[model samples]
Every structure is written in structure tokens, then in C-alpha cells.
Target: MKNNWADAMRKNVHHLAGSLGNLLVESFHYLALFAIGGITAWAAVMAFLGMMEKGNITVDDILLLFIYLELGAMVGIYFKTNHMPVRFLIYVAITALTRLLISDVSHHGPADLGVVYLSGAILLLAFAILVVRYASSRFPSAKVPDPDATVKGALTEEKGET
Candidate 1:
């Protein structure tokens, strides 16, 4: 009887420790995501203000704003779904490369070889986005349930709804 009691106590302690560890990890995950989302929002606001102060928004400035928008959207989607949209990052890369290409061509003329390389990189990223989209569509994974859905389900059950 004493041995059984000791085993039960051990198991309970192990379970408690596991639960505590999971709670800590989940707390940290949420905190870090919130910090990232907040920073992205703040940086985007600052960049917009800078453009307003300049009073002349160039193509480069517009492209930079697009990059910021993609970053903010990526963060918001990740926060909502707990999944990173790889395509958004690819979109960001393509936009950044296009901006760089424009800047390089304007400063160095059309004879510069860097334009070709940047264009090639942008093309590759566009292809990668296509491939990712194809694979996701071909073999979609299970969707993550919405947090509110569970609460709504419980409420429905309590109300004796089918």
C-alpha cells in the first residue's frame, strides 16, 4: 500500500511539473509574439511619419511602405493563426529586390549587371511562392481551431442545442 501511494504521488508530481512547464512556454510564446507585433506596428508608423515629413514620396518610399505592410500582415496572421505565412516573406523579398533594382538602375544606369541578378532573385522568389501555394493546396493540413469557437461550443451545449 505504501509503495502504491508513493507511485501515485510521483505520477501526480510529474504531471504537475509538465503542466507548469507547458504554461510557462505558452506564456513566453504569447509575450514574444505581442512584442514583435507591437514593434512592427510602431516601426511602420514611424516610417509613414518620415514620408509625410519629406513631402515627396518616391517609388522607393512606396516600396518600403509595402514591405512594412507585408511585415505587419505577417505578424498579425501569425498571431491569429499561430502559423507563419511563408508567402508573405517571399512577397517582402520580392518587393525589397524590386526597390533595390530600381534604385540601382537609376543610380548606375541600365548597363549595370546588378540589375540582372536582382531580377533573377525576384523571379526565383516568385516561383518559390507559387510552389508553396501549390503544395499547400495539394495537401492541406488540419486547420487550427479558433479559441472562441470552443467557448461558443460549450455555451451551446449548456443551452441544450444540438
Candidate 2:
């Protein structure tokens, strides 16, 4: 009985600590999001104005599009899910690699070219795994309850119902 009581107390303390920590962390996240959103909005407006004034569309303009889009996506996802996932790291990595490749491919040698190509391949594989994992997790074996319908058939039935 004493050990059980101790364990219960420990659990309660652990839960309390976790709750407080999460509250502190989320508060910081909200502040950071507000600051970043303000700065990004200001910068995006300035960049659009600059592009229009120049009359020449540089790759920098396109880069700005991607940066703002990804930033917005990251912020939106956090608000929706209340937390970020490891899968987003793959997306960010791929985007960063693509940006680097686009900005510097002309200045690279054969070895550098191979490295960039390999980086792209690895990113592709990571994205494929992420897709498969997300798909399987979201839509598990639908035929588990009724074996007569194959998984694919069950998925088709699900789609039809939806």
C-alpha cells in the first residue's frame, strides 16, 4: 500500500511537471510565431515591391515565394496539430537542398554535381517513405474486420462511402 501510494504521488508530480513545461513551451512558440509572421509579412511586401520596380523577375523572387509558402505552412501546421512532426524535417531538407542546387549549380564541379544529385535522391527516398508511412497510418488495413474484402477492396469501399 505504501509503495502504491508513492507511485501514485510520483505519477501526479510527473504529470504536473509535464503540464507546466508544455504551457511554458507553447507560450514561447506563440510569441515566436507572432514575431516571425510580422517580419515575414513585411519582408514579402518589400520583396514584391522591389520585384515590380525592377521589371525583371529574378530567381530571388521565386525563392521568396517558396520561403514564404513554407513558413506559412509550418506555422499553419503547428496551429492545427499543436506540435510539429519529424516528417516535416524531410520536407524542409528537400526544399533547402533544392534551393541550394538551384542557386549554385552553375558554380559546381563534377564532384559537387554528384553530391547534389545524391542529396536529391536521398530526399526523394525520404519523401517516399514519409508518404507511405502517413498513408498506411491514416488508412490502416480496412479488411481486418471482414476478410472477404482485400485491403484494396476495403479502401475502395471507404473511398466510395466518403
- Candidate lDDT scores, in order, read 0.88, 0.70
Model 2 spans > 4 angstroms off? 1-26, 106-162
Candidate 2 per-residue lDDT over residues 63-95, each given as its tens digit: 666766677677768777665644555566666
Q: Report the alpha-carbon TM-score of model 1 versus the true structure.
A: 0.82
lDDT of 1 at 137: 97
Model 1, 62-147: lDDT tens per residue?
A: 89989989998998898887798999999999999999988887777664677778888999999999999999999898888764
Clashing pairs in 1: none
The lDDT, on a scale of 0 to 1, for candidate 2 is 0.70
TM-score of each: 0.82, 0.52
Count backbone overlaps in model 1.
0
In candidate 1, residue 155 scores what lDDT? 76
Clashing pairs in 2: none
